[model samples]
Target: MRSIKFNIIVLLTILSLTTFAQTKVVSNSYSFGIILKIEKFAGRDFRYSLELKSTDTDSLKNIVIKVQQVINDDEWLDVNLAKDVTKDTVWHSLKISSKINPRAKEIWLYANFEGNGNFFVDNLKFEIKTESGDWEKFPIKNADFENNENNPLKDFRTNANIPDGSTIGLRNRTDSIGGKALLIKTTKASVIFKTNYGANKRIGKYCNINGIKIYYETYGTGEPLLLLHGNGQSIVDFNKQIPELARYYRVIAVDTRAQGKSIDNDSSKLSYDIFASDMKALLDSLNLKKVNVLGWSDGGNTGLIMAIKYPDYVGKLVVMGANLNPTENAVEKSMLNQLKKDLKKLQQKQDTESKQMTRLLLMLSTEPNINVEDLHTISAKTLVLAGEKDVIKAEHTRLIASNISGSQLIIFKKQTHMVPNENPLLFNETVLNFLKQEDVKN
Candidate 1:
């Protein structure tokens, strides 16, 4: 009887401990979506992301962040928030992502640190992704919960009755380095997002280019004007000039393979030469013997390759922000570093969209190393364009012009790499004037 009593007690104790451990707070997360406040933010979708530094108060800390989407009033669908997670007790930066519903009027967020002890999370920030795929830190606007502007929730909402002995709200705390840290302390949390719809107006068609479905848009009638967008861009990059250009010419704006609406099928690693070849093949598929090509950024670099290697197919060319060497003036070092970090973050995702992004980011950070002498061989009438504030250095842009025989160089005053978007009126006029200029027939 004594032995049996001791065994039963041991079994009960084990069960109690197991249950306690499983119930401990570990996985952390937040919600962001469908907050209808201002008119500007209404009827849009967004890619919401979070980045924050965390310190564990206990060695048994296991951290994970997840996303949940609202299905109805009482039930929510489980969404994967962590692209990749590594359990650690040390200081680490957490990255989590989720998307917002354009149609839903409301949404919620939840998070927890599921382990044996508490961990202080700080430097917490929620970001909404831009059309360029860059994340912008969200600032508080319309602190009102409803029509009432004085509601206590500055930028979020949470329930006070949740059991787990965990607290979820903003708190003041000191960091390990003796600095003031304001943390959005949460065993669970929620936030908001407003989408920008500038890039969604145009729908495009995809045609096979070297066995890959390349997305493109065409309009108007005259000579074929093949407009190529920059790195990480779509047909929308030329939104400012498309309509005007279409009025004068048959504008063929193409989204390079694996970018925008285009899908990729090539098994080999992508390169500028590959894109150039694809553009040449696209022209062939459309039954055009020659066409005028206008390229921006990476597109410009690809144009240089096309004019050099497939000289006969390109009648006239305009290359903007093209660089012969990436190390020299391709982009700022800080921008390159950010690309590397973004590539690392996307690597953890199992989705094809994420993998395609990794490929494009990889292409931007490395690869393109053009020889200036190659420019001398291009047979087409060429225009080399750049912005004064372009990411590519001034001298490098001039170098490209010097090498290309009789090429015209024009630098837009006070403009940057995104001249097409920032100074659309000027960009359209300049490109149109150059395209309409009569040079001796090629």
Candidate 2:
């Protein structure tokens, strides 16, 4: 019976010690600014720490310091009130034991003055003790929650308006390839070559064929070179290489369907055939019988399709990060999540039609029909460029190069899916070299 009683007491003592160890407090004494208000805060949990340093009883009676919690704009909670004790210098420590609401966005410690008499407060601090879980900071700033005249969200959302075909303004500004702007104004003595072409309003003068508008911005005077952007990007994705490539060839950068200023129609019905047909239409519209093609990612896939389906229109094909197989499960899941988030936001803003279009585009982007067997049919002089870390595995790239008759393969060291964008200098140099080599061979 005695052992049982002793065990119960020991358990109680352990519980008490555990509770005490969870909270800590410290105090400091320093003077600054107004006497009626506390100037400097030094230690933690000062809200619970009370100090009285006075021998004269009359002077102490008029002093009062209250600690309050600012809950919101109009609400406050008074949690501490210090009492005077007889001493020239006195230090008091208090431990705070309270439950805090997990959902409360912000908590502020405020010192409230009661009487007009000068009251000095020094070394004030408050630390919240929580047993719940680790706190995660939200990305939204304090200014985002404010709806007044100085609110930043009003201007933020206004500037975030990314139209279908025009450039998508980067949120975090950088001079990187993905963020560079495309120069679109016409120059003097520009050659006008017009043909029967349906213009897509979104991507400014790019031709639409078989319900897909291929984005193409042209410059310089030479053999035509069709440029294709990678996934999740538009013509703007090739901004860095445009000026240089344009100097040598009549470079035409295209934003494939569902990416950058291009229309997102029935994405579910999308395939390389649709993209190839669109390119054929674009070529037919421009009255160009044949052209060199440079494609990145999905554009590479489209280029392969064009070479296979309409070999007459392709002069030389340079394909980068092109995948013969469908995207893997992990890649598909990540892509779907991003698409879902975008769709949700669009739906919330009453963009019902755009939501469906985006969904269709995602479905098309992940279609599993295209494979290595289909690539064997390509007859164009192909130069397969694969980034070292490209989403398309090395074996697949090798297979693509092997299957395509007399195709050359070049692997860019230490590169990824955005190799063209990430390493523009190397990408351009390699392509120019390959084209020159093909020229010699032909």
Candidate 3:
């Protein structure tokens, strides 16, 4: 009986060690690439291998694996792997090995396609070198594309834009090796693919504040400009604004506590006040005295609080879709009702993470009891922005603008709260114009 049990344990361990774990990439546009979120794999020697097939009858020169590491603020170490691929529908075993920079602030691993074709990938394996020099397998969930989820490509993230006349999408199909494979199909349209904006490792770092680790990234140089994203969002939400803003000022994009890469350890409730305090501590850690702040939604609420309570830390302030209170008078009834329903569902889950999310929803439903008159106390140069059809009532937005002395207001006509992302060019220009204009002399 004991021998049988031991054999069973050994078999289970062997099966675990042999499981295939890898990512999939598909290209239907001019370029397609998969960015591996491999922070834990950094500073280690690793190998990635996969079975690949293509329908294109040309040489496979367009397919390559790229390893990029940041050497400094302006330099990088970029290497291409798997150089001997050929055009074939048969299974080709492709593998690459490299060392990740131990001191790099950012690193990227990409499986890229730079042509038009139907590409299939399956049975991918990722391995890391152990201390004793043997390779150990690292398991990626749904790596085999056999998961019975609604979306077979649930774990993969694609580029946001698919150009006109381009047919870029994912499908699960029978493959030669495994029973199923991920097919990336693209045609006609030319689209350029690059690294994810906020997912860059070279510029991301952590700071200890309020007993939690806060994640942030820095770009460009000049007067400090701080960026804050909405609830359940990270620095990625500011992707449209960062590059342009970086050209003029030092951009500090942060992932708020309990969101993005930031981790919260305390069980205390979350509030705009706490978020504002976290920003203060983060600024102190960076030795920043004052900064320009751009915030959206929940971020906007936090920025308003910071201006009210810690005015000394604010140089100029811009907030979109912020509300003084969590009431129907301030927020739209439909949105508020939906949030309450979500809070109820979260409360029923009763798990640790769910409870934390419940707290977030609870805060949104009943907190931020700011007096409209408090806007009068903010001392920083302020710009209040919102969409004409914003979730926040038009009257509430105007009330906020009217209470703040010398503050400017702009409501984008026929737009929604997502104007920043929907019309980034216009949003960026409007923000820059406001930030750059000289103050009027009395």
Candidate 4:
């Protein structure tokens, strides 16, 4: 229950600045150190790294990084580094051992210099994380996950350690999505793990919500942000977004009931309210009272229902390509026609994957009948966003925006329903700006 500024630092004679995902010593001239204070648990893995081009790279003996644990408001005790590695004349890293003080409320990583020379550091990043909280916010520097062509498997892999004979190809979509993840911003916040996969496994869990097993993965650290997938799509639908949002928020991306890895208990029907109810239950299971909600397509419809029905549970709402009614006017006829064709092709196949795909398609073709007037009932500050060339009509998006009292509306030009994938930088920037606003009246 700490404030956003709980990470307040007291750097001594060091010029430092941090953007969305980067922290650096802007221009330090004296024999100074960059100090970062974070509210995190003890005995957790702490890793930080930065490049250095000092007045002399010939010697790093002047560099002495000291890890400290807070005792009181003003007192700190030296904590031993699990792996002290300041020996490199090149880019050095500080990998603090998992050994931490239990009474410590805040830990500080100080880059100390004692000699007469100067030390310069940039690309500074810190990670005090566990496995379940593992997330990767992909930065623009080297993000290339979206190059899939004839085969989707080329872009995605099944979770680690699938059975020897497990299915491959698009079946990777259903198998499970797990691997070493990263989160990169202007300056990459990297966790270089020499540890094995046991320590690197992304935290994936299943919780019983609304009498069904809801599967989800959480990553990064900050205000809780919920990501809901589209109809017939899995949490992997947000493969591009998770890395983008994890840069600032603790992202909880879920596979809604009856879709993706979630189970429906043999129920053939799924509704927005039911999905919304499951989301509420998920919050309860996670012990989180309120979270920011970002939903796309059918998930967006569910977000509207959640905001309207369970106002207290939603802090902010961002819905993209959502429709009040599942009709031709509300949604594009071309999209419906394509879904019909895709469903028909799936229905003709007898494979299990085809059956599952067809089931989800059927759900999308129908359901979601909202009253545009009911949009006024949403108490959470809402952001109704849609692509200029969205499957959901532009006027319909405007209607949703106009109805929500103080909602912000943005229609991205030259984009379709898949703006999150097609134009991620724009989509992420808009969402981050809206989420970061501190004075929005609900």
Candidate 5:
């Protein structure tokens, strides 16, 4: 009986050694790949036990195993034995260990031949040896099968309790919050243009004003000119004319509220007033007493509001493709309705918040006040620009120029609403000529 007991102990020791072997090889090409599906777990360490057999010892050293989480397809983890492993016999066992994050739902394992060798595997096993405890719990409690619905949390004092209200509209907010690094000032640098010198530089550190953080870039040196962009575009939209405009004047371009790298706010409360206020805050933050303003599309309307409500902050104004009345175009009304419908679908889908914000901007952009008479009260030196093909007829642009005392009108012959982007050279030439005239008068 003692002899039999000793033999059993020896067999157990051999089994333990066989179980810990690290290399696995397959025999037939058809049976080469192995699929491992890990069970769903909030937090756990996944352990896999693999059995390997190689008909040719030369094949063991060339074995490779690929491991990856199933949900995100782009990333992969590779596991390899420390040394070459060749199997002369059948059913050699190996153990592999990996830790899965709390959020992981499933994982996969595949075995492949690194070279021409072949082998097979059986008696595969997987288990969770440990669990992660510090990981944050899912927001919803009792969210199990059949009842797995959740709602976003909101602060009533700031944002509305609506799930959509809590979302900030932006993608790549972390990376693009200040525009791409490529577009910003890296260090103190200056470029010399034909007539003037331009310096591409950042003006100030990021600051939160009225619950929004604003960033601005400045170019050239002369009378301050504040350039505002339309919806869905950042300050980068001025890249084409930055160098040229900077050559003549101190050109400052800004990423408006909830767009580009600017901080997002409650979408439900966002209106043109909020954007105008944000621009005012930026100017105040910069300590600029007054500036010449140039705005395109939504930016143009924003400039008009600034000139109307805070006339002291603006010296001269140039507005392009600006609508003085919101109800002038039926097409715009139809577009807004379509946008509202699309927004509802987006809310239902709970898609990216930035996409929703983009839709909202589109709706607000076309709702400009159409009454050109409003410009008559603006005291700043004014330039009304319209693309020959602008949705606002050339006659309407002339009407705007006529209303504002001493305001000049320029029409780009073949241009449309997108003059700055599509006809940078012509737009810059026209703007420079007007600014030069203003300089001569001053």
Candidate 6:
């Protein structure tokens, strides 16, 4: 009986220690922020700038600070926030030039820390550019962090619920600029800013393609360049490439049928051929004679079909992480297995959403059965790309490129199928270089 009682005590002690460890980890992770009221300067073009300093320069690599100019409760403006702060133990000036909404009622700022770090911020300044080409300071309360005399954290706010001690905290401290500064400290936490890409009315538009509406966004104006996203994704997937590509070409980013804002009510099974047909119809509606095409994954398959069936519509083609078939010879066995498992689960459900998902999965598993010899029919100058670790087999990608006469193939090293999203700068550069090349007449 004594031995059993000792064992129970040891088990209880171990559980207690485990609980304490978990609490300690949770306490170390938190997020904090502050809201500054600035409503007087609505409907004006202005430049927002701030000075920030970090104790550890390495930690700055993971910290995120987002500034939003809120307009009338729901409307908001995203400022191209400062991301070049690469210095430590010294102040760095971050500036952004953007126009404010005419109906803006308030502006808020939030800072998120990914790991244990401390940062100091001061001199939050906003300057409006006058019509006469002059800069004037807008009236802002506590523009500098030197007003908190009685309260060390008068205008500050944090997630720290404790009155005295917490993982996340705010306080006033003296800085090298000979003034008080707001000190924000956090142990660890994560915060992601929700971005609206597929639904941005600023650039989004729709055109009737067949019986369904196809949503697309256009930017810049040199030559039309169509961007097609992967399966189950929309314009949001190409958000990183659109703006940069827009600088050089007329970027036309489209939401494939049944995805994003292009809602489909038809109960038919999805196929790359149907998707390619929709693309051709969309280009026709836009009055585009011939345009360059950039496609990812499933979009790549659609592009291939478009080039095969409607060669006159495609000029230069770039396809990344695409495959000719749905079998293990094209895609990794593990990916095929996972897709089959997911499709099985979705098939058991009867909801509208589940049915839609089932269709997408079915298409991924059994469609795009392109014959390698069919690629020989493609006359468009093509650049085939895939990541070294992509779900699509490397040899399959090479086979597609080899079959297409005079095509170029590149495999991104140390990258997966998500290279376009994971390292967009490199991906965009490679794409731009290829697209800007002098075309050889077929």
Candidate 1, residues 1-442: lDDT per residue as tens digits? 1122222222222121222113222233222222222223333334433334454433333344444444333223434554315545344566655555443333333333433334444444445666776766555443212222233234543322233444434333444544322233334321212111112334356678656898777778999998888877777667667878888998888888788778785545778998988888888878885688899999999989889999878888998888876774656676567667777877788787767777887888786888988888987889999999888888889999998898999988898787776667888888888889987855
Q: CA shift at 118, candidate 2, in angstroms?
A: 46
Candidate 3: residue 210 Cα off by (Å): 3.3
> Stretches of candidate 3 above 4 Å error?
1-193
Q: Largest TM-score belongs to which candidate?
A: 3
Q: Least lDDT summed over 10 consecutive residues: which range in candidate 5? A: 180-189
Clashing pairs in 4: 82-97, 136-182, 136-183, 137-182, 137-183, 137-184
lDDT of 4 by residue, 1-442 (tens): 0110111222222223433333444221112222344444555666554334233322222344445666443335655432223544443444444445656766555443322233444334555566587732212221122223233223221122222222222111111332211211112112221211111134667888646788888877999999998876777667668877888999998988777777665536667888899999989888886699999988999999999898988999999999988788888897788778777777898866666666677777887888877888987888999988788999999999999988999999888887776667888899999999896444
Between prediction 2 and prediction 5, the one with superior TM-score is 5
Error of 5 at 243 (Å): 1.1
Model 2 C-alpha RMSD vs. true structure (Å) is 23.6
Question: What TM-score does structure 3 among the candidates reach?
Answer: 0.61
Q: Residue 161 in candidate 5 has what lDDT?
A: 16
Candidate 1 is scored at a TM of 0.56
Which predicted model would earn the best lDDT?
A: 6
TM-score against native, each model? 0.56, 0.50, 0.61, 0.54, 0.51, 0.60
lDDT of 4 at 36: 42
Error of 4 at 263 (Å): 3.3
Assess each prediction's global lDDT (C-alpha) against the native.
0.62, 0.52, 0.72, 0.63, 0.55, 0.73
Q: After superposition, how far is residue 369 of candidate 1 from its true place, in Å?
A: 1.8
Consecutive 10-residue window with the lowest summed lDDT within model 1:
189-198
Candidate 1: C-alpha RMSD to true structure equals 20.2
Ranking of all candidate structures by their lDDT, best first: 6, 3, 4, 1, 5, 2
